[model samples]
Target: MDKLHAQRAPGRPKQNEQNIPLQEIILRQAAFLFMENGYEPVTLQQIAKICKVTKASIYYYFENKAELFTASVVFMIQLAHQSTLRYLEEKDDLRTRLEQIAKAKMMHAHVDMETMLREANPHLSEEQFGRIRKAEIDIHISLAKHFQFAMDQGSLRSGDAMFLAHAFSALVMLGSRKHVIEHNTPQEDLPQTVVDLFWDGIATQPQHRK
Candidate 1:
């Protein structure tokens, strides 16, 4: 019995053909669960269950639920950054690209990021907090770069690219609010409406604006 236990560790992670690390698989599933439910409500056991791994197997990769939650949120943020880049790269027209990004973002019901982070706050360390913030900023910077390019080309009025990016993000976040969304406006039109509102304000003949 001792020899058998030594040969096969109890916490050995499951393997896959793609060679993706068990850590990544765990992070992916954990991110989904954390995003679906808040950090406080999700447990390492639940994450392990979702990933089809034993709780001890998760412990091999993460120290505790807090560490797992931090990693999961960072993973989710990086994935969002990648998805945003793909959408932005799909079109050249600023309005069209913005609309595409908005539509993709609004397609799902968002767990309010601010609220989620607030819930996770006590569990995260400063380094963990920094990681999440950097990942979130990566998406903003990508959008800002695109906005800067359009501004440089005289396609958009001269203004702060980063601010525009933030404004656009805020406008899209409104789509996630139930009361605002429930107000007569059709769900399908929300993305277009958001883009229109953002564009109309900035798309005025390329004049230098403070």
Candidate 2:
């Protein structure tokens, strides 16, 4: 009986410790599965199996599939926001910073949360969809602030900061596709090439050419 008690006591603490990270693990794995298979095809059972947890365990963290999907979008955007903050802190020139941002976007292209959400739109509530859209807009606003800073520093031409930011983001998004990455453009040179094309078009004069 003493041995049984000891075993049971240890098991509870071990279970608690394991449970602590399960929510995040679920979000990450769910995001990957949703991105890989889209929302319609992915089942809670599949997510539970992949996370080695029961459907009840997932329900403990999220109310339903839509909630889980929304939370996963938030999780991914938060990560990207943190990365953007770190990249913006570097002392590099504007072009270099933009290149790094583009490269980072390329690295994460496989995640494609926006596309996945669009494909799964019918399954999501307006509130859930709005949450994801707001997250994306927040990122765009952050990037626009950076563009405004670059304009002030004369690293880029003076223009509508938000518009420039949108254009730059669109360019990065296009470059992030697998087909674009695998094209004749070498991976190492792609980000730099993208930056050069963007900056050259928006830069002030011949002296701005680099």
Candidate 3:
């Protein structure tokens, strides 16, 4: 048996034996399962099986399925936020940066909120829901700050930064929908198209002749 396995006790596992990479593996697998098959259908056992660990090992890190699910979602949100930050850091104009952000979001947009909420087991409490909402707000604030910077640089039209951030986020989310993406929008062209649509608007530009 492994040293970590040998260190396990009857009731609880040894905390010191736990490793970060292993924990992250469990979280990733759990998050994938939760997104692929709704939360209600995924079990600790399933996560453990996918991670090649025991159910007790999973419980050593999480108290129950709800806790595990919450942790997985939090992990994914943090990753998405980090990716967005990286996209914003790229040396590009506001339109290019926004397109990069949209592409990043699209890559990580497998989770569906309505379906996840409906299938969530043990039903998330108000407090749990609040935590998720706060994570989202943090992302919003980060994006809003980026938008404010772009506006200051005169790259984007001046408007309420917060509202523009939310609108931009909504547009990115819209791109994630299967129906919207299935209409032969080439993968490479989709982000640019989204940016152009937002920047130029549906109405004809004054510079363009009929």
Best by lDDT: 1
Global lDDT scores for all candidate models: 0.81, 0.77, 0.76
lDDT (tens digit, per residue) of candidate 3 on 1-210 = 555545655554333355647778888889889876788778788898888888988976776788888888888778888888888888887678888888776665565655686667347877777776777788889989988888898877799999987777777767776424474655666677777777787887556667
Against the true structure, candidate 2 reaches a TM-score of 0.81
Ranking by TM-score: 1, 3, 2
- Order of all candidates by lDDT, from best down to worst? 1, 2, 3
**Whole-structure CA lDDT of model 3:** 0.76
Q: What is the TM-score (0 to 1) of candidate 1?
A: 0.83
- Give the CA lDDT, 0 to 100, for residue 140 in model 1: 89
Question: Which should have the higher lDDT, number 1 or number 2?
Answer: 1
Model 1 lDDT at residue 74: 88
Counting clashing residue pairs in each candidate, in order, gives 0, 0, 0
Q: Estimate candidate 2's alpha-carbon lDDT, on a 0 to 1 scale.
A: 0.77
> Which window of 10 residues has the lowest lDDT sum in candidate 2?
7-16
Model 1 lDDT tens row, 149-179: 9999999889999999999998888865652
